[model samples]
Target chain A: MSAKKTEYGEDQDLLMKKSDRRTFLKGCSVAAAAASAALTSGCIPSVAAENSEEMKLRWQEFFKKNYRLMTQEEKDATVARLERLAKLRDGLDVQMGSYPPLKGVLYGYGFNITRCEGFMECVAACVKENNLDRKTNTQYIRIFEMEPGKLDPGTGDGQYYHKVPVENKFYMGTQCFHCENAPCTKACPTKATWREPDGIVVVDYDWCIGCRYCQAACPYYGRRFNWGKPEIPRQEINLRQHYLGNRVRPKGKMEKCTFCIQRTRKGRLPACVEACPTGARVFGNLLDPDSEIRYVLKHKKVFRMKEELGTDPKFWYFID
Target chain B: MQLFLTGLILLVGITTLFWGRARASESSFLDEVKKSTARFDNRSVPLVKEVTEDTVLSHEKYQGGSFRVLARKKNIERYQCSNCHNDKPVTVNRGAELTHGDIVLNHGSAERGLVCIDCHSPEQRDYLEDKKGRKIDFDHSYDLCGQCHFRQKRDWIGGAHGKRVVNWAGDRVVYNCTTCHDPHSPRFEKRFPATYSVPLD
Candidate 1:
């Protein structure tokens, strides 16, 4: 992988590593010098001395290693720093943790089209759970009310439908499908987004360059790009977070649904699944034969959104 | 004062005796139901379809169909039917003067020509009755429901019909029929949904 040459006529991997190391060392030395100067100069405080914590946090944020490359200690330090920053900025005492996927468990979701009443309870729960930008009304889940007997989501109306569960209309929801052959991951210029071992497509928010390539590549309109800083009220912030899932994202980053990685990896159901009053959503391990998802796939008439595209979405829609 | 105290003690003793007896009978009945369900769950029926390698390669053992459904007796408004029908038996013909005016009876009553005795046991106001006249506890109302809606009952047992609550990993716990549907009027009412998401386009 390192031997490959690019248009620049240099080993891109080597060049990138060298530049990263140089910047990291430079930042460390500067922070050290500033700390010592602050300790020594008691009378005339430097600018770094006044906002040392903030400055250190910024430096650390800039120099933080990629989540996949971070050691255990580094991950812990990063989590602690993020928690502190959340507190400082929004007065939120957020708890962030990284949970690995369970062994022999591949998560899958089934949507019962016949049962969904277009309640949109899942949408509201998702917004609160994922800490989406309220000002822009950023949402990961969209419930599309389609004409009866039609399966095309493109023609469905997401906004105008009222008095839902109408006589002939059926509701279908869309989110990140976490496809096995995810095109969004391939479209990423920086390789910041990839499918996890448990088949959840996740994005490293820090590593995303905000190119919006993944957004264009996605056929289902799964990814959402932050146009501005997310407006999450301090009191409304969900403290429980995962590094790759619902952790508070910054401006100019890309994010999508991770099937509630923080909750699912910990053996709990996702907030959306629990919030659906109509029992339209079913989530479980595909590897478990007795799981409700597997049962639906076996017994019900099931179909994926875009089978011709061959994305191999883990999501399935079924009717009674 | 001495006579009053003696009478109070006697009354307490009698109440305790009756309570203990009732609890013992109820628990024994539940145990019997559990045993029967456990046995029934173990009997294997033919697979709905052949399990191919793609479906069952990494699949764990099939350990479903034995979950407890949520009980709705506690959530029912003015639950104790015996409070009103203690001394008198509830007759089916008490139409205009029916005490339960609030109940619309739009479920099977209007469509399938079902009366109160079709489900509720007249012999015991609190217990549900099957076609065979067996009394069913509120917790085991699925048995009563399954008698008529066989397909839905089959799906419910197979973990396809209702909602599973809490953890998705361990034993599946689901909500009962009454949890979502009112017994008198089983149809769900249409209403405005939750907050709308702004159009992304």
Candidate 2:
């Protein structure tokens, strides 16, 4: 290839190797300058505008898999695995990886599949919340089709709609329905994918060696394999970093739905739940009978995606 | 004006392709003037020449009957475009297989009129097997339909539409558009307001 004209300046090659550090500093400097400039002329990067640090961090970000599938000991081991990784990550904000241990956290989710429309808004939100790569986006929530009221479970295309609003055809989204007895963890040769406290399932992204066992063990087809390091623009990045979930995963991690643990465990709803326009997603403490999830369970005809396997999945679908 | 809609549809469709599964064929079954002027009779089909309120179009509309026509790719297969459409709505694909949309989704709205093609695209089809001996086409196929039924799309994206089954840890996942509707006709799986989850103010 011919020597390409460069937009990054003289040391472009040097800049490429240490993109994380240089990009972060550049972003911070840009924002700091922008804020100061804004104070004087109101012409800097506004709060609404993209954050350079966040944007720079976009390509480097990743999400861990279902943490809910892990047992206590393995979960702690997984936490340690993540901490070790934190020390080496490129754009580690506070401390690339080395930080605190997993604390007491809780997880839970509810869905009205009868109400699901299959837009993938939640996927986008998951990407943002977890700082996922723009390319792969890691999370594997595919919307499928089936006979309505028939409930054959994740059998349809999940993503193929031609003319659209395929009425009379059923729609169902498949994600890591965090199960009480997740089979993925059982099938793992290495204790990589595990369930976290608060019920969200997560993976030690660094520890995963790109094996497809967890994915195969997942009857729900909830797991994902990063075939390639995600390809994305640095400017389109998300940098509000988290240690466990989607704060920049690497090239070959096995990932799945975390119930937006980074958000939900902190009292916030997962991105998808909030993005649902139909309110088909009902999120709350499942243990709390008064919670909306409880109402859904009591009033709606709900069933797990797969009953024969008896994964004891936490995720359920309902029809009214 | 129609071109403006086409432009938007194109933009949305392209984005949708990457956002979704892969493809579905399309037909010129539903259109406003076509539906009003009318050619075919009853039984509701996608691309009949005539138009009516009770039925879109029937088998009498075309002879070849849902065959592939777009120069044919290697493994890609096209279905009868009019199998599910009719002139009462008149929607067709204009490229943007990315969205895979092809018709207008009323979502049980009284205001829903013709312009069905406004929401629907030509439907992208790719059955190509990948290096892993598995399919490598984009996922999220329903995104094509979500272009117009944006509210539904939003819900789907948020793990509301379709299945939205969540983790044992918690929260029902969101869905995509295809979970409920068929691109050819765009109807609900059950009754009116197929999506009762959305508020009706």
Candidate 3:
């Protein structure tokens, strides 16, 4: 079998080796089928003989290269194939595009602990916006209602709060802070999860090896592993997707919040920020001094969760 | 015949005086006339008093503000204050049997010695009244709210208080103060959130 060489010679060699192994397996399977046919009275059915569109798609998916290594043409082809796969599997006409980070903008978020009414509007909006797995009940943003005068998240109760904005209690929300010094990216063996130029930590779903190392390494418990196929209802699926963001995640992949990359990259606010009724959530460019996030940082008493770790999280919680 | 004519004229004059007093006290006669005429005339009378062509005012264009504040009139729930109050002159002393009986003015009554007319315009029930006694639209409620909550108003202007909507970049459109807080009862009440917290095991 002839092998084609690309710019990534090492990756090309690996691909060639994989193809060679696959051909060898195919030959072995054929030989095994012949031997079985000779032994049996009737002709044995060959598994490889039934080549369907789905089978071809599965093969293409298996051979798909890492997102980082993919050429522009390869990326486009992969996006097309993924779109086709989504349509075939879920009947969703999803528009998946890889949006590059905006120039001269580093996205940062601020949460007013005083203003957050413990209303999970942001959480609900996030689940819908990101197309998170409904079966696993996957959520990126977790609002913890803390006791009065206590700032520690360790003592905060995320669950079992009957009523929100409980007297003397304040709410603090946590998500992927998109740390400037992200530990998850360091822990990722496949280099699937990394921070973009605009400071959003994103996971290339196809590239993730489902090792859960990132999950363990993350101090904020930001990453989520898809144990099974993300069971999203067909009608509820968000068609607007970023390739590295809220795109329909496959099973056994790690996923996290990308700050609504599809929306934010286009100068729109994140779903959580828009959904917040109390204006508790603030998001804007950290670079722009005139931006709301900058104003909050400058005026309010802002603190990050696990600040001692020195992850340098872009997300900050402030009190009026 | 002369006595009968004089008695009839005197009786008619007394009746007219009584009718005028009744109309003045309770302007329901005009409402009744309107209701009766409305059946025949399909065109409904305007609920809000028509601002004369000369006195008509437009909201000052917010130029170079950090964010574009949304008009409150669009967002007010069950906003038909003028429906009942248009023809009726608001009595200064309604004797605690409030017209807006549901509205509990707990915000400024205890601390600031404020009444309904303090913020809300007595003449225009739909619009708010500012410290300068200028008629303010419901859209510009921040002006009225800013009178007392100056710190919060400053924070809002500076982007620390209130919610911003739509795109974060470019023209920011923020919710007005009255959008989240009820002017009658400004405190945010404790209630069940939209979704429950996912238990972190």
Tell me how each candidate scores on DockQ against the true complex: 0.19, 0.01, 0.19
Candidate 3 lDDT at A1 equals 4
B76-131 per-residue lDDT for model 2 (tens digits):
23443334333455445654552345434454356855343333233322322322
Q: Lowest summed-lDDT stretch of 10 residues in model 3 chain A?
A: A1-10
For candidate 3, what is the DockQ? 0.19
lDDT of each: 0.76, 0.49, 0.74
Better of 1 and 2 by TM-score: 1
List the TM values for chain B, per candidate: 0.59, 0.26, 0.55
Q: Which run of 10 residues does model 2 chain B get worst, by summed lDDT?
A: B24-33
**lDDT tens readout by residue for model 1, A1-320:** 01111311332354467657867786886777667656646656675465667667766776776666666888889888888887776678888987666765668898999999898999899999998999999999999988987898889888854777887888999999998667898798877887776778999899899999999999999999998777888788888999998998989999999999888877677889989988889997776667777778789999999866767688999999
Better of 1 and 3 by TM-score: 1
lDDT score, candidate 3: 0.74
Model 1's alpha-carbon lDDT is: 0.76
Compute the lDDT of residue A156 as modeled in candidate 1: 89
Query: Across residues B1-201, which tens digit of lDDT does each residue of candidate 3 receive?
Result: 999999999999999999986644453211322232111110121111221112112232222243456666755554767866776676657635455576677776566766788888888878889889988778778877887798898778778888665667655566678768888878877778887666653
Where in model 1 is the C-alpha error above 4 Å? A1-47, B1-65, B88-98, B109-113
